[model samples]
Target: MAKLYFRFGAMGSAKTLNLLAVAHNYRQQRKKVLLIKPQIDLRFGANAITSRAGLTCDADLLVSEKSYFTLKGNDLISHDSLKKDQKNEIVLDNKLDYSCFLVDEAQFLTKELVEALYEITILCNIPVIAYGLKTDFRNFLFEGSKRLLELSDTIEEIKTTCFYCEKKATHNIRLIGEKPVFTGETVDIGADEKYRPCCKMCLHKLKSR
Candidate 1:
């Protein structure tokens, strides 16, 4: 049976790179892979799924909080066709014959969307791999990550070392002008300069200062 897989890591753990590599492997084997990303992640571009190492690919599907999915025969429909009100939803007429579905920045996804992806894996018999940070800078579980942890058939952690030490990093520290700050909006989108991966001790040390 196909499984819903959640691969999470702290900031700078190369989650996006891993996702891109998986997609490449699938395509190299003559299999189709669908790339998906949350519409909120515009760090690279509106539709670009970019890795920090410089590799990039256009996302086939850009999902938002208002987006939902339904299987219509062998195809997947993004919005409800019967519902006359399609206000903020993205409508897509895409076939669901892909061998795999890969999602980047999965933490930004809404809980409802995560549930829909989980359902797709079972109903469509297609494996879904979602890569993202397990927790926010505030050490809180993201809505999507929380649901994935609960529903995914396989949960894996992509490991990386702490920025200040050789120990493994388990948390993210939000930064502004090289100084760590704990108080801010939950979803401040920025790359390397804005966040640092820290271990428990280093995180606590930084917080105490």
Candidate 2:
């Protein structure tokens, strides 16, 4: 059965780069892959997903709070060609289209959207791989990440080293200059100048008292 996956990490975890590479691999094999992104993440560009490492790709689908997702592509090709057997295994369409779905900057996704994605994975029999930060700079879980944690079939963390120390970074610190800033909107989209991947100890020490 197809699965919904949540792969999360800290600020500089290269998650977007990995997502792009996976999409490329699928397309290279002559398989169709849908690249989805939250409409709120325009840091790179509109309808584009970019990594701090400079990799970039245009998103095939831009999901908003009110947007509804289905198995149809931009070409209006319906995925109704598929059928399920008595054993609950999904039989593919004659063309074997839509190999997978990849989502970038998924932390801004709404809970309803996440549930819809989960349904898409199971009902459509398409694997959905989502990449985003597990928590905000304040160490609070974003709505999308929280829902994914509960609904995802698999959860994984992308590893990165702390900017302040050699420990594996598990926390994200919002910084303005050398000091940490604790108050701000939870969904600030930025790169190295605004956020840092830090260990728990470094985060505790860096936060202003």
Candidate 3:
């Protein structure tokens, strides 16, 4: 049976790059893979998933909190592919569509949307690999990440180094102009400019100063 896999990491963990690499591998093997991202993540642009390293790919589905319900049945992916006139249609043998579902920036997904993704694994019998941060800069669980932690068939951590320490980074620190601040909006999005990964000790030290 296909499984739902949640791969989580701190900031700068190369999650999107990993998603793109897996998608590339599937295409190279002549298999269908569906790339998905939340519509809220527009740092790169609508329908685009770009990595810090410059690797980029257009998303097959850009889901919103409200629109994610479309994943039920054959409507969500197949219809969108047709509407976009995408060259690489997800269908196989004129029936099955997308052997795998790969999602990036999954932390933006709503709880209901995460449940829908769960149903896709069971109802569609396809494996789903979702990648995103496990927590916000405040160390609080994102609704989608919380659900994923509870429901995913498998959970994996993508490791990265702390900026100031040798221990594996587990927390994300929000910075403005190189100054770390604990007060701000939870969902402010940016790359290296706004967020940095840190270990528990360094996080404490920075917050204390």
Candidate 4:
């Protein structure tokens, strides 16, 4: 039976790099892999799935909160609300041709979308691998990650060291310039200049200062 797998970690953990490597291995074996990413992640580009390590790939599908999925015959079709023309709907038909479904930045996905991916694993018999941060900078579980933790057949952690020390990083700290700030919007998208991965002790020290 195919399984829904969630691999989550703090920032700079190379989650997207790992995802790219998996996609590479599948394609190398002559198997088809579908790449998916949330529409909210524009850090690279609208359709680009990029890693900090400089590896990138265009996502096969971009999903938003308004997107939905349905199975037709052997095909999985996604109906997206990205178009302003109400009469013409945009559809992505996945004819069950792919051996696996790989989603990047899975934390930005809506709960409904995660459930749809889960259904694909069971009904379509395709394994789905989702890579993302488990929580936001505030250390709160993202809606998508929360559902994945509850429903995923397997949950794994991708490890990375704290920015200040060698301890394993467990939390993401948002920064403006060089100082850590605790209060802000939950969904601020940024790279190294705006965020740092910190262990529990380092986080406490920074917050105490």
Candidate 5:
């Protein structure tokens, strides 16, 4: 049976870069790997999956909040083109040919979709590797991460040290320029400069008056 793997970290933890490398390795071995990204990720472009370290790839699929995800890439392809283009029609026709599935910013996935992904792994026998932050700046678990925690067979923390301490960083605190702030939407998008990774001790100190 295939396993669901959840690899999580705070901001600037190189999760996306790691994901790209995994995809690269699979392709280099002559295996077909499909990359998936949630549509909420606009920091790089809605459809492109990019890492702060500069590695990039065109995600083979984009997942919407209310969409059904099969092991196939049919959900992301345009329907009109599917009708006009014979090549595309054939691609969607037998969509289970993908060897692997990789998702970046997996934290943005909807609860329903995460469950679907879990099923895709269990029944379809495809390994699903998900990368994203476990918690927001407010130190609360994102919906996708929450479900992933409960569903994944293997859970690994992509290790990055706290910017302010030697302890392994598990918290993300948003910073505007240089100041640590406690305000913002749960899923605000920004470059590495806008967020800092911290350990629990530093986060408590910063949060306390």
Candidate 6:
């Protein structure tokens, strides 16, 4: 049976790049793979996933919370060639007939979407893989990440060193201008300029003094 996999990381941990690599692996084997990204991430325009290392490809599907539910047997999708048009044409409904579902920036997903994803593997026989930030800037659980933690068959953390201390970082620090701030919505679209990865010790120490 296919499994639901959640791979999470802090800022600058190459989550998207890893997700893309997985896609490449599947395609190289002649297996159908779908690349999905939440519509909320527009840092590189709509329907595109661009890694900081310059690896990029157009997303097969740009989805929101409702993509999991938009399918209700309306799809006439056949064969396993996995064309990009097939993805955009099929409405996301409870009936998951696809080979695989992959989501990037999954931290933006809603709780309902995550639950539906859990069902995709168990009840619908579709494998689901999601990659995203594990925690927000304020060290709180993103609704999507929280749900994934509870429902995922396997949870993996992608590790990287802290931006300032060179320690193993587990947190994403948000910067407004030149200074760090602990405030804001969970999803902010900024690359390199607005976020930093920090270790737990540095996080606590920075917040304290």
Predicted model with the maximum TM-score:
1
lDDT against the true structure, each candidate:
0.87, 0.81, 0.83, 0.87, 0.81, 0.80
Q: CA lDDT of 47 in candidate 1?
A: 99
* TM-score-sorted candidate list, best first: 1, 4, 3, 5, 2, 6
Among residues 3 or more apart in sequence or in different chains, the pairs in candidate 4 whose N, CA or C atoms overlap within 3 Å are: none
Clashes of each: 0, 0, 0, 0, 0, 4
Angstrom error of the Cα, residue 13, model 6: value is 0.7
Candidate with more favorable, higher TM-score: 3 or 4: 4
Which lDDT tens digits does candidate 3 get at residues 62-98? 7765553443234433333233433222222332377
At residue 37, give the lDDT of candidate 5: 89
Q: How far in Å is the alpha carbon of 31 misplaced in model 3?
A: 0.8
**Residues 25-140, model 1: lDDT tens digits:** 99999999999999999998899999889999999988887677755532233444435454344433364678999999999988878877887887778899999999999999
Worst 10 residues of 5 by lDDT: 84-93
Task: Give every collision pair in model 1.
Answer: none
Error of 2 at 75 (Å): 20
Better of 2 and 3 by TM-score: 3
Error of 3 at 44 (Å): 1.0
Task: Kindly indicate the candidate among 5 and 6 with the higher TM-score.
Answer: 5
Better of 3 and 4 by lDDT: 4
Distance from true position, residue 66, model 6, in Å?
A: 4.2
Mark the regions of model 1 whose C-alpha exceeds 4 Å error after superposition: 73-94
Task: Count steric clashes of candidate 3.
Answer: 0
Which segments of candidate 2 are over 4 A away from where they belong? Answer: 70-96
**On residues 27-50, what C-alpha lDDT tens digit does candidate 2 reach at each position?**
899989988898898787788788
